[model samples]
Target: MPVTGADVRRIALALPGVVERASYGTPGWRVSDKLFARLHEQDGVLVRLGAIDEPELREVLTDAWRARAPKRLVAELAEPDG
Candidate 1:
C-alpha cells in the first residue's frame, strides 16, 4: 500500500524532539521549531535533507521523482538542462 499522510505523521512524530505543526496551512514536521518536512499542496510530501553536494542531491531527487512523481513531470525534470 502507498504511504499516507497519517503514516508520515506517525513516523515523523516518533522521532525524538519532532513535533507536528502547521506550515502554510498544511501539516508539517519540525524539530526545535525548524521545519524538516511538510505536506505540499501540489507535490505531496517535501522533506529537507541538509547540505548535500549538487551532483548527489540531483541524483537522489531524480530517483525520488522517478519513483513517485507523474511521468511527465519526471521527464521534464530529467532533461539535460532542467
Candidate 2:
C-alpha cells in the first residue's frame, strides 16, 4: 500500500519524545519541539526519503528523532538489546 499521513504519524510517534502538532498549517511530528516530519499541503508526507517504503520511513524518522532528541535519549537508542 502507498504510504500516507497516518503512516508518517504512526512511525514518527513511535520514536522517543515525539509529539504531534501543527506545522506549516499541516500535521507535524516533533522531538524536543523541533519539527522532524510534516504533511505537505500538496505532497502528502515529506521526508525527502525518495521511495515510500516502511524501512526508509522508519530510518528517516529515527534520524530526525536522533538529531533533535536529547543526547541521553539518543544514547539509549544506541545501546544494544540485552
Candidate 3:
C-alpha cells in the first residue's frame, strides 16, 4: 500500500507546531519554522524529510514508502498531542 498525497498532507498537518507552505516548487512542511519535510511533484506520494541529512532521510523515506502512510503509525507520531 503506497501512501497518497492526501495521506502525506494529513501527516504533515497533524504534527504539533507544524506549518504547511510552498517552497522550492513543492509543498513543504516545517517544524519550528524550519523545513522538516516536503512533497515534490516528481513523486506522487509521501514526503521528503528535510531535517535529517539527505542520505539518512532518503533511506528512511524509502523504507516508509514501502509501508505507506496512515498505516505507518505516522499519524500516531504526528498527532499534535502525541
Model 3 score (lDDT): 0.55
**1-82 in candidate 1: lDDT tens per residue?**
3455665666666444557899999987666566766676473324333334444544543453345445565555556764
Flag regions of model 3 displaced more than 4 Å. 43-81
lDDT (tens digit, per residue) of candidate 3 on 25-52: 8887665456666677574434333334
Decreasing TM-score order of the candidates: 2, 1, 3
Each prediction's total of clashing residue pairs, residues at least 3 apart in sequence or on different chains, is: 0, 0, 0
**Candidate maximizing lDDT:** 2
Model 3, residue 42: C-alpha shift (Å): 3.8
Model 3 root-mean-square deviation: 10.3
**What TM-score does prediction 2 earn?**
0.79
The lDDT-based order of candidates, best leading, equals 2, 1, 3
Worst 10 residues of 2 by lDDT: 41-50
Error of 2 at 62 (Å): 1.0
